[model samples]
Target: MAISKKISVLLNLADLLAKNKPEILRKNELDMNSFADMDESMKDRLKVDENKVDGMIRSLREVAEQDDPEGKILYDFTREDGLHIVNRTVPFGTILIIYESRPDVTIEAAATAFKAGNRILLKGGKESFNTNTYLTELWQRALSENGFDTHFVEYLNLSRDETQKLIKENTHNVDIIIPRGGDNLINFVTENSSVPVIVSGRGNNFMYVDDDCDTEMAIRLILNGKKRISVCNALDKVLINKNLPELKEKVSDFVSELHSKGIDVWGDKKAASIYSEIKETNDKMVLFEEFMAPKIYFSLVENMNDAIEMINRYSGGHSAVIVTNDAEKADTFMQKVDCAAVYHNASTRFTDGGQFGVGGEIAISTQKLHFRGPLGAQELVTNKWFVYGKGHVRE
Candidate 1:
């Protein structure tokens, strides 16, 4: 913690990072193109392409250079006995972040930790080892340049066995563990890790087309929501009103187009004639839940009440969008949907850090405790009370 030790650490990390920059950039360049061309499975595992990764680092640098998330005074109160209570924000100190194939997550999580004054141990998806290593090196370089402890951003370059060992053995040193991946991966980390967890749950976002929705705008919004279906915020479900004007003509045409583009469609018997492209099975429930990204389901509902019930039954508690020109209708749907974020007149895909005007987000938090939506550095800090009082004897 000494000034000299800090300087030494920063300098050494800077030198190591400087030595590795060119090689890292070269590797990233190759990854950029190859990753962009990869199929849905490979792309989903990586999450983002290289150009986006570069943009992410830039965004982090800008975010870090801004005012700190900590150092803010939240509240102050005084008592009649000359006692004062002041609430101030502070960092969690040490955090462990476990995530799947989104390589950019390593840098983003590290930046949030750095801004909050916490040390981070990152365990990224093995599928993106090469990408993770270089990104971690980039973040270390940034930390060194800022004269912060480079070791504050650590990584465990190990397989499943070693990862489980660290989680089991170093629980005491870790103040919190954040899991940022699929349901199974997150469940595994949360169930097994001895440290407290900030779980970022998986998203199966929904999009509802209300009777008041503009048909042209609805098509555009739905396409935008599902264009990048691999993302956590991508629209996974589409709900259409059973009795919209030209309901069959407008929605049916749009749904058919989606099917042509490889999206699957499922729905009630009323919608069955429109979505024949979706391969159905004898088991209705099985077909309804089984979504492959281009696939969407349409169900005819009598009113907003039915739509609300359907959403509650199917939503994965991440993001939901309601397309309605009517203000009251939008409000009703938003109120009924249970998720981290709800949208009106916009694509569910807009549920993102940058979209919300934050420079970047650690991840979309589905948990209610520390954070609930797109999380920036401000979401990374906890609060403490500072009390002051004059001597007063008890009666």
Candidate 2:
């Protein structure tokens, strides 16, 4: 099919989604009870149709217009033989994404794969089967309408066992497999799959508010990061300096104030002094991390060195926030923190696809290679060199 026709089909899918997003959100909200039974294994919900699928296509189309991320020559140099050598961008052939209960994955993955000019196959979580099915159907329809093989962007329809088969036995067909979800889900895919896997590192995200931080700003950021605390990027641990005279009082007041509003808070010895209900434990829950919803824990530090030490001890390199007016402190934390996404004063929630302005993204990759932070359009692509040289033969 012509590139223009393919582009048209994608654009139409976007328009349909923009017009119908309100309805989709409304429908999901109205049926919230049915969608609320949470499972870590689930990829995303299954309720997508033409309208839902369209939005994803639109975001990809928007990013594609920016510039061809691939195909641009990165370097050119002369060899000892006076021959020209060049390096450029190219696709990674076919990419495979294995994930759970987030319908947004469908659009983000599809759009990005399309933009990169690489074929893709999605193995969605079983929980979101119905939703992903419809979403895939719309994509197939779009492809058929544009006279292209839907296989270029296929959605696999196999069980967990079948998914395993594809990951292991079908390694020849799939170039790379990306597993997105929680720790266990990602772990399972990484361990069992024979194909090369890019570990989308487990989220042990953190938020730290130094003694120099603005109290009002600190409270707002904490609330935003921890309120819906079940998310991957939600603030899991909060660290505060013990040197400030009002350190205990200030943090306690802010934490208690939120606890009064149906938020659950658990804190360490220093944090417990402020809020009585905060859970106190000997072993750092930070070590064997639990992704709890509506829970906030605290750790007290003696100084900057202490704070940095604790941050290093617990942080799994997912996300961290430093709430301080001190430029040096923020800079130090940014340099030391091992996480994929590091924050200065903003909430950990800002570690999202939409906020990062990549149109949209899949999971924020905790891994370093292939992807890190938000997995958007560029993450979905791999580059190869395109050389145009005259009489470039070896001696």
Global lDDT of each candidate: 0.70, 0.69
RMSD of each: 4.2, 3.6
Number of clashing residue pairs, candidate 1: 4
Best lDDT among the predictions, by candidate number = 1
| 12 Cα displacement, candidate 2 (Å) | 2.4
Once superposed on the true structure, which residue ranges of model 2 sit more than 4 Å away at CA? 1-6, 18-61, 78-82, 290-292, 387-392
What's the CA error at residue 322 for candidate 1, in Å?
1.3
| lDDT per residue as tens, model 2, 196-267 | 777666666677777787888888888887655556777767777776558657867777777776676766
Writing each residue's lDDT as its tens digit, candidate 1 over 129-177 gives 7777876776676566666666888787877877777777774388888
- TM-scores across all candidates? 0.85, 0.86
Judge candidate 2 against the unseen true structure and give its global Cα lDDT, from 0 to 1.
0.69
Candidate achieving the largest TM-score: 2
